[model samples]
Target chain A: MTVIEKVSEHFRVMLGQKKEEHLGTITDLMIKRYALAIGDDNPLYSDREYARKRGYEDIIAPPNMVASIVDWSVGLKEEDLHEDGTPKTGGILPSNIQGIRVMGGGEMKKFINPIVAGTDVYVTTEVIDTHVKEGKKGPIAFLVIKNTFKDAKGKIYCISERTVIAR
Target chain B: MSNTQPLQVVYSEVEIGEELPILKKNTSPLQLFRYSAITWNTHRIHFDKEYALKEGYPNILVHSHLHGAFLTQLCTDWMGDRGELKSLEVNIKRFAIPGETLTCKGTVVEKKMVDGEGLVTIDLKEINEQAEVCAPGRAVIKLPLV
Candidate 1:
């Protein structure tokens, strides 16, 4: 199928196909590892005592760290797993345009609460919109998807809009 | 990565166009491993140099989250104890490979009040040694209204 044809087909199949999961609790290891990777020396992400002294109950994650909390075990819970987790049928990508290069075009987010270590992180993702534009070289697809992250109790921490571009 | 000056920021005392302290760090291959391990990102492009070469990159590419992390650090460093980051969104423009010195900078773009609380918006950027923009981001922060 042509790129346009494939994208149109995928769009219909993906409309409102929301996927969510209990990605498990946030751990100090996850927080500190992320902090260390970025070489951040902020105590709020490392020292529990320091965070408490600063008014947080536990070590709080850096705001942007929320994006890295996906369950990597390749063993997502049944409910959290989509009907087909394969790249061809899942997670926002349009199948049949396999040869195109994909890039993260941009992101927009709104944070409502802070996510602290030990709070179970949950994320729900779905397609909000999609647009096909003609680029300098050819047609490009901008897949706009929104992912909401919250603690297991349902208190939202943040909502992010990710724009994935395919050329 | 050892340490730096203490962070001290208050909303009312700050002004628009004020610049935050610059955050500079050299990314290493090992640091990339830690980032991938922590985030559970098994993408070969982040860690495998051969794969990167096949894709026409000079070296292993820095994870996009790493760029966002640096941008986030800049915002939090300015916020200090009296403020909190409300939101951050970044657009990755170029690939920052391991060992390049990346600098993060920000400027306060707007300040306002919501429900008796102070808020500030910042325009953020991360550039490589060559000074090319790698990731450009924006952040909204909530500050104490003392």
Candidate 2:
């Protein structure tokens, strides 16, 4: 089978599969690091007092934080890692397609609500669809997955549909 | 229970053609490492230069998610204290590396009053120092009617 055909076969089986878990919670240090790493010193994400003055009890996380969820709340065990250093599991996107190149370029995001530090987040991910198309490189497979993040209080912070291209 | 936007932008005062102040940030190897660290991303292309070269990259590649962070900075910084970012859609058009300067700029495309909040839409772009478009996107922002 061609690479795309093999990958597509795998993706079709995974479609509609849903994984639900308490992925992780936002934290002050994590928020600050994320902000500084992006070189954004916006007080909204870094200073508690500034956030309080703005009527927030604590610092807020960058809006995109939910979409970048990288680990379980506790920690990522060694077994969860791939040889290349990327997390091997948890994401709805298909993994371990030998001889196929996969690239995640960007996202289609909807920030339903702002996320704050210290919020316990739960996530539900489902593989929504998959399709194949010819590209400049070769036949490209677009795997689309939807992720929804809700706080412990049941407030939805963000929902995203990300596209991962595998060729 | 609702947080106002970061900017004190009055809904009626904003015009469709208004441009948000450009948000620019410089990238380097260290900052990229920090981003990857915080996100638990261990993609070798972001940290291992030699491996990146073998993968045919000139240097370590900046995380695609980092581009999302840069775009997020542009909106939150521009909205200031009273504008809420209701939604944002960013799609990367190219890969950017460290030592490149990425700038986020957006133009107001539509404005309206919906559900008692002033909502505006923007067409956004993240461009590298070389004048190449790296990511292009759109956002929906809610502003205070007051």
Candidate 3:
């Protein structure tokens, strides 16, 4: 079977499958580094006093911070990584599809609450849908995944739906 | 230290069709590398130009999430302390490489008073140096009523 067909078939079976993970605690340094990396000067992500003045309990994470983090666990050994440098596991796709190139197509996010610095974050990822589309070069596969971030108490921080393209 | 004060946007003062202050970004290879490291993204296309070319891109590509970050900053900076972002959606239409200038802009589209809170919808977009639309997005924010 062709690669696109193979990937799509695999993703189709994963539809509705969900996996929950402990993403660890949100730290002040993580928040600050992310904001600085994006060149965002918002004091809400840095200064504790400034954030407190704005009603947040402490420094708040950027709205998209949790969703942008690619991995939360300790990384794989270098030899186990894909040729492309991506991890073989911990991703939505199976290891067999490592040869294919994957790209982020887009995302839709709903911010429910501010994620505070000391909050322990957890994520639940579910494969909502999958399909194949014809591109100028060839057929491409699209995987639609939804990620819900919440605290230990199950207080949702945000919900994000992302489209991943495989070619 | 940079100024910690945020712009106080009053709900009653926001007008439909108003334009947001533009936020411009120019990505360099070092910046992309740092972003990748911070996000724990091991994808080579974002940092290795050789690997990126093998994949048919002109150079190392910018993270799609970075585009969203720029747009988020555009909205948050404009809304400041008086408002909170409720939702944001962005679709990547094209690839953006390093050294290209990406401009993020938004236009206020609709406004409503829901449950004693003012909600505003803004259409957002990020354009590349070639004037091509790299990403188109939308954002909804809640503001305190005047």
Candidate 4:
């Protein structure tokens, strides 16, 4: 069987399967770095007094920060990285598809609450849907993954539905 | 420093079909590197030009989430401190390389009062230097009613 077919076979069976992860605490430095990377000078992400004036308890993360972070782990060794520089595990897809090119198609995100600095964050990821479509090259697989980010008290911070394409 | 005290957007003043001020960004290689570092994204296509060429791209490509970030910034900047982004949706239609100019633009589409709060829906898009629509998106924001 072809590699795409093999990966699809595995993903088809993974539909509705969910994985939960503890993303650790949201830090002020992390929030500041993300805003800086985006070139966003919004004080809400950095100025605690400004955030408080805006009704938040403290500095808050950018709305897309949690969803955009690819890995929350400490570190990964170079030898363990795929040729493409992606991690061997913790990706949205099965490890068997490591060599295949993966790209983001799009995302739909809902912001439920502000993620304050010092809040412990957790994520629950689930494979909501999978399909194959004919592309210019060949058959491409589309995986729709849903990620729910919440705090320790079970208050949802954000829910994102993202489509990942494998070709 | 320019937006340290952003203008507050009042819901009563917002008009339907009004175009938002454009936010233009030219992704530098350094910016892309910082973005990858901060997000812990080690995807080679975003940084390694040789690998990106081997994968059929002209140069290192921009991160998809970066497009989302630009769109989100457009919304937040327009709404200012008094407004909150409730939801945002974006579809990346094309790949963009570093050093290309990407412009984020949006138009207010609908307005409503939900639970006495002003909610505005906007149609958002990012255009490349070639005038190609790289990413199209939408956002719902809650603005303070004054």
How many backbone overlaps does candidate 2 show?
10
Candidate 3 lDDT over B5-93, as tens digits, reads 65588789999999998889999999899899988988889999998888878999999999999999999998877788999999999
- lDDT score, residue A40, model 3? 93
| Overall lDDT per candidate, in order of appearance | 0.78, 0.80, 0.90, 0.91
Candidate 3 wrongly placed segments (more than 4 Å): B1-4
TM-score order, best first, reads 3, 4, 2, 1
Rank candidates by lDDT, best first: 4, 3, 2, 1
Top of the candidates by lDDT: 4
What is the Å distance of residue B14 in model 1 from its true position? 0.8
| Residue B128 Cα positional deviation in candidate 4, in Å, after optimal superposition | 0.9
* DockQ head-to-head 1 vs 3, winner: 3
Give the local distance difference test score of model 4.
0.91
Q: iRMS of candidate 4, one decimal?
A: 1.4
Q: Enumerate the candidates' DockQ scores in order.
A: 0.56, 0.53, 0.74, 0.78
lDDT tens digits, residues A1-167, model 2?
87688888888888898988887668899889888887877788888988989788899988898688555555566677555555566543345655556678568888887777888889888999899898887888888889999976778889999888877
- DockQ for model 3 equals 0.74
TM-score of 4: 0.95
**Model 1: per-residue Cα lDDT over B23-131, one tens digit each:** 9978888999888778765556778788778878999988877888888888887787667788889999999999899999999999999988799899999999999
Provide the lDDT at A39 for model 4: 93
Interface alpha-carbon RMSD, every candidate: 3.7, 4.7, 1.6, 1.4
Where does candidate 4 stray beyond 4 Å?
A93-99, B1-4
Q: Number of the top candidate by DockQ?
A: 4
What are the TM-scores, per candidate, against the unseen true structure? Answer: 0.89, 0.92, 0.96, 0.95
Give the CAPRI class of candidate 2: medium
